[model samples]
Target: MKGVVISMIVVLAMIQFMVKPGQAISCGQVDASLAPCVPYLTGGGNPAPACCDGVKNIKGMAATTADRRAACNCVKDAANRYSNLKDDAAQALPAKCGVQMNIPISKSTNCDVIN
Candidate 1:
């Protein structure tokens, strides 16, 4: 069971590396870029400079519609990993970081809506 769980984690982690169709960014990039946003997104503290930097980085990575939606899904999945993650704060991070997200950051955001 333990090995199975670890394998599943590895698979999910690798999922971000697979670029399908017109996707411009990978989920791995999204994960790394948003690592600094945990405190603000989880409501543990205000957005730090590093967090804003990460937001800016994500803005650059998600350059295409497929990439934006992929990043959104990645972010949503990451947030869902945290039980206390706040939807409002997650939605507000982009604007707060001086970046505007083409797709909203809510967990309910449909990645397929990019078209």
Candidate 2:
């Protein structure tokens, strides 16, 4: 019985290494996808086809809650990187792209508020 328990413990430890738990998707994916939307998000122009495509891509990538939160944080950071971002314009990208985001994408948005 003791040998069996030891073997089980070893197997569990190996499994832990193989499958890292709580590994949220990289925020870089979100950043890359949304890069094209910067001009529109900053109120410089209407969202282009590429910008809308990025929004769709990001929306599809952020499937899990953790991924969504990470995406929200990344997008918020990206938004802050801009100089003259209009809040309404930033908020309207999702609608323009026909992709609804679980987490709001804005410089002033609180990532913690997203699920």
Candidate 3:
């Protein structure tokens, strides 16, 4: 009985370390943060100050690989909804907003591959 209890405790401890932490950001949060940038992404114009703020907010929110992947997936979904999204403009958005994204913002990017 003593050995069985000890083994169970060890297994539980190992499981704790094996579990990945949940992402801090949600898809809804990602959408809210990036919504301000839609105009610049679809049309040719400088990104608004609010848009840049949103970009910076997203960059700050994505602190882990899981968070980045979630954000990437959200961005891809949003991009897919916009038929007029300019690829070049979308790609340049981060830089234009003075934010550096770890993951590429495009429909083609595989969110699962991001680490």
Tens-digit lDDT string for candidate 1 (1-115): 9788557555644664564745567767677667667778887457899788878877877787777777888877877788888888888888887887686666677778864
After superposition, the stretches of candidate 1 with alpha carbons farther than 4 Å from their true spots are 1-23
Please identify which of the two predictions, 1 or 2, would achieve the higher lDDT against the true structure. 1
List, residue by residue over 61-85, the lDDT tens digit for candidate 3.
Answer: 7889988998899889989989999
Local distance difference test, per candidate? Answer: 0.74, 0.73, 0.78
Give me the displacement of residue 23 in model 3, in angstroms. 5.4
**Cα deviation of 73, candidate 2, in Å:** 0.5
Per-model TM against the reference = 0.74, 0.73, 0.77
Best candidate, TM-score-wise? 3
The 10-residue segment of model 3 with minimum total lDDT is: 12-21
Candidates ranked by lDDT: 3, 1, 2
Which is better, 1 or 3, measured by lDDT? 3
Write down the TM-score for model 3. 0.77
Which residue runs of candidate 2 sit more than 4 Å off their true CA positions? 1-23
